[model samples]
Target: MSAKTIMIQGTASHVGKSVLVAALCRIFKQDGYRVAPFKSQNMALNSFVTRDGGEMGRAQVVQAEAAGLEPSVDMNPILLKPTGHASSQVVVLGKPVGNLSAMGYHTDYAPKALAIIEGALNRLLAANDMVVIEGAGSPAEVNLQEHEIVNMRIARMAQAPVLLVADIDKGGALASVVGTLELIAPDDRARVRGIIINKFRGDISLFQPAVKFLEEKTGKPVIGVVPYFQGFRVQEEDTIPEDRSRAELVEEQGWVDIAVVNLPHISNFTDFDPLEDEPDVRLRYVSKGSNLDEPDLIILPGSKNTIGDLAFLNRSGLAAQIVEFYRRGTPVIGICGGFQMLGRELNDPLHTESEIPRLDGLGLLDTSTTFAPEKITTQVEAEVAGSGLFLCETSDNRINGYEIHMGRTELAPDVRPAFTILVRSGEKVFFPDGAVSPDGLVFGTYIHGIFDSDSFRRRLINTLRRRKGLEPLQASDTLLVHEQRERDFDKLAAVVRSSLAMEKIYGLLGMEGPICHG
Candidate 1:
């Protein structure tokens, strides 16, 4: 039997489509169905590396985890990481195709891209009992609809029932939903089986009349009214929430204050989520021109455009501030692009990433980086080669993380290696991964998620605390990152099951009776 498919398209960006897909994936998995999530294309700076050395959008990775499955590049066939305001680095099936502008991508690439999208979708359908598809932006984007492979086109290809989701918290939920349905082509509009009013704040009971009115006017069932859920952490696709301000960090008042230099085109910001979860650590993303506030530890995060963002740091004077902080004996760490920025120079002779031929780095680390044509997207296992300020007290020196970068970093002969890479993509290997200063005050690594290990995070936080003349705090018994996400998946599934009309959804999918086991 062919697998059943359902597509979730949003009225606009960040209308909670990704979260809803994740919730449904968990719900289906709990109901004894082998489920998977798929997106034809995703445009986001945030990304994840699959176990097979493939890179995809972080949202699909979260949804895959929700479905109790490993992430795969097929889940998100095309990922566009924006390098500038108008240009993006396009990845097809986990490999960099080339940088392209919006017109170039749509006019020259969309047709071929659609074939790959369908191929991936078909493969997932063949393997899973159900596949949940999440569309980008809106099908109502009439200007882009002609070449839209992610929304109605995929809906038509799979003949999947569509759920149009609108964020009620942003207001105009009814009009947005109705307007979207009305704007799309009639055949595509007919594919929408239901409407989901998402992010509804205040009393949900008060929204019953509005739901009724919507269903009455559109002849589509208001399948769900999802309340604005808080404290449910999931990996966002592109941008960080604006409400995550420095004020909140100050109020939280953890023992150690860590500032992340948020670059203009920051990628994989979720790399620091584990640190944010630590009770003794206060993590804040300090943008260009923002005050660093004398942070005990400063982090230069991964960026989509390393050279461009490095210039940004220089132009914004954040680079100078970082140097001053390092000189003052405060710990500074760099990851991926940030690691490249910490080196003596960044050379892009082939213009692999940007037009910049060569750019001087902050010179914090005795290393240089050269942009390479082949992008590295692989999982890695490494052990601390030498004890640094952060790794000094870590009980388990072994770390598990992934690498996704476009440059190869070479350290000066006299520089100390930070971590020795043991395995790449599940195979054993031997190589140094990062550089550490003689004083252990500055560190740079190509590895993302280096702080995910609980022992590592705890040790780093406590070490900073000790430097501030504070006693060490007890280690947290909290769940690991993966385990916590599994629990979050269940929590989200439970809420969605209660909020949504499951019977109606099953009816739309042409399934009957309860599939849940317990």
Candidate 2:
């Protein structure tokens, strides 16, 4: 029998549709059902690579994890990573087809993309007991609704009951819900079995009147009003978070100060998410306009456009400041495009990444990068070399990360390799992966999600603790990213369960399941 499905569509982007879908997936899994998450098309910079070398959006990755499944491209059939304001690198079923403009993609490619999306959806439905589908942006975009496969079209195709969500925190949520229902086709509106007001604050009772009005106006029940919650560590597939104040986090004597330079087109920023969970770590994103405070460590994250973002670093003066920090004993590291930006120079012969043919790098490491036409999107296993200044504390040599870039970096003969590649894309490979400076302070690697490994993250934090003369915490039951996420998923499932009308939600599915406590 084909799996049952429910679609979650937002009134607008970032309306908490992704989080809700993940929560529901966890709820279904906890109540004894084989559940999976699906998103027809995702446009985000945050992405993850599967073991078999397929790349998909991180939102579905989180949802898949909630459902107790490994991330795969089948979960998210289409991923569009924005390369510029108007253009994006379109990846169908986890591999890049080509970069296309907004008009080009919608006008010329939507038909083919829709076919691929449906095929993937049918496969997911056949494999799982239930598939929780998440939509992108809004279905009410009248001009684009005809061609947009991410919203109502997929809902109708799957015959999935729709849960329309609106962010009340953004205001006029009632109007948004009513307007969306009115704007969509009558048949599409009929599929919306319920409504949800997400990210609500204050007493939920105070919003009861509005909820009642919403229900009456749309002829649907306001199934839930999810409160604004914190401390739940789910990776977001939206914009970069603003820089935050340290504010005496972790309840410790001191902090492991870290500054991540937020690039214009930063990608896979979830690399630093694990750092924020550290008990004494003060994780901060240093954007272009923000002041770069002196931190124990500085990181340059992956970028979509190496040359353009590197030039941004130059114009913003972050490059010079980062070099100054490295000279002053601060450890610096870069990943992917950021890895290329740390070299002596970057050469784009075929203009694969950017319009500029060549650009000077930060020159922190003794390396040079050359952009190639082919992109590398693969899972990697490596042994961290004990060569970097702060790497002496590494208790674990085996670390795993994914590479998504189009540049090849070569290290100077005198510089040490940061990590030795063991296996790449299921193939055994023996080669250097990254470069470490002579003093072992500045380093750059192609590894994304490197810090997610507990062994590596804890030791790195301990290294910074030693520098500050703070006592190191012994590793006992430290939470790995995977473990922590499982717990968080349970917590999220609990929160959502209590907030929503569970019986009614299951009623919408036309199926009965056990109701378990959070």
Candidate 3:
């Protein structure tokens, strides 16, 4: 049988494009079809490690989950991680090779990117019954459309049928549907087989007239309309713009509010996810123009471009605000890039020409960070260095995490000591490489994912609660909530699998008949 591919192009980003593609992958997989999820390229810091030690966007990982398969680097060939507007760290099949500007990638590497896309597609075709491809941001971003490697070109190369997805929740999604069709080249427009309206809230039937009008105008079928599912916890793809209405922030049960400095190009912002699951702790992402509002703790998060973000923080006046927060006895914590920013100065002479012209840091920690060419990437297990912030009264707990950064920090004089660098990389290498300040108020390390441990989370929340005069949370309740959410996500999959037209979906995906349910 010939390979039949389905491409899901979004009218805009964060529409239910990823989820819809995932649902389709699951539906076909249950019908006894081997399916794979493909994205020609992705720009996200929310990434996942494949079994082969390669990394790709986490959205692909979730889609792989829906298909009951493990994630592989081949599923996403090109990954563009924006370190700054002018430059991005480019990864080919999950390895950081070099950095390039957006224009440089488009002009110099478009042909090569095409080859990579084709190579990934060829493998998918040979191995799977169908390949479901997810597209990037808006299809109509005119400035970014030329020599495109992701959405349209990949579709054309694979000779796949396209299903345009619009986020009806974003409002004017109908307009997005029409606008996308109008913007594409005539030949490209012909490839669209249908459209899917996704993430509609309340009474989907209310939009029947709007749906009919769009179908009549574009002459493409509306395959399905998916409603919003609340409890589904698909891994996020990027730093979803920090909004006030985030559930994690509002529903936080932690008595202490932890403020994270939102940098311009925040890396691995999802480091806060495990912490979000704790009912007691509220994680606040504080960006420029936002007030500190007296947070119990101030955390400096990782940054893709540290020096650039430092300058941005200074420009936004948040840097001064942070200094003030430190003076006011607020506990300050820095992680990775945030840790670098807490130093007296950051030296990047290799990339920048300036020397000795120090960018003022928070000065909470007596340290200086020097940026180097090399990046560190690997999983690590560590014991609490000295007494960590959360478990000051208690002893070390096993912390499993990873490190991804480029810098060396040397502690300055007169700062209180926090963690003593203990075992690293399976060796008893202690106190030589990394350390926290003495007071424990200013703490940091190059480690990312430092809070993946459930014990660490509970201790942090319990510490915050005790400080705020609140009772400790029951462990059973938290476990029950997460279990219920997973059950809900499973039901969500069943809903999508049963609602869409099965025969047509199987035919579109080049799959045999569905198995008998009875």
lDDT of each: 0.87, 0.87, 0.73
> Which pairs in model 2 have colliding backbones?
none
Candidate 3 C-alpha lDDT tens digits along 439-481: 5656776766676666666776676667677777766645333
lDDT string for model 2 (283-342, tens) is 888987888888999999999998999999999999999988888889998888888888
Model 1 lDDT tens row, 223-297: 988888876677777767552533333323346788999898888899888877665666788986679988989
| Cα deviation of 312, candidate 3, in Å | 2.1
- Deviation in Å, model 2, residue 408 alpha carbon: 0.9
CA RMSD of all predictions: 2.0, 1.6, 3.8
Q: Worst ten-residue run, lDDT, model 2? A: 386-395
**Predicted model with the maximum TM-score:** 2
Give the count of colliding residue pairs in each prediction.
0, 0, 11
Candidate 3 Cα errors over 4 Å, as ranges = 1-4, 25-34, 48-53, 124-129, 140-146, 239-254, 352-358, 391-396, 411-434, 479-488, 513-518
Q: Candidate 3 — worst ten consecutive residues by lDDT sum? A: 479-488
lDDT of 1 at 136: 94
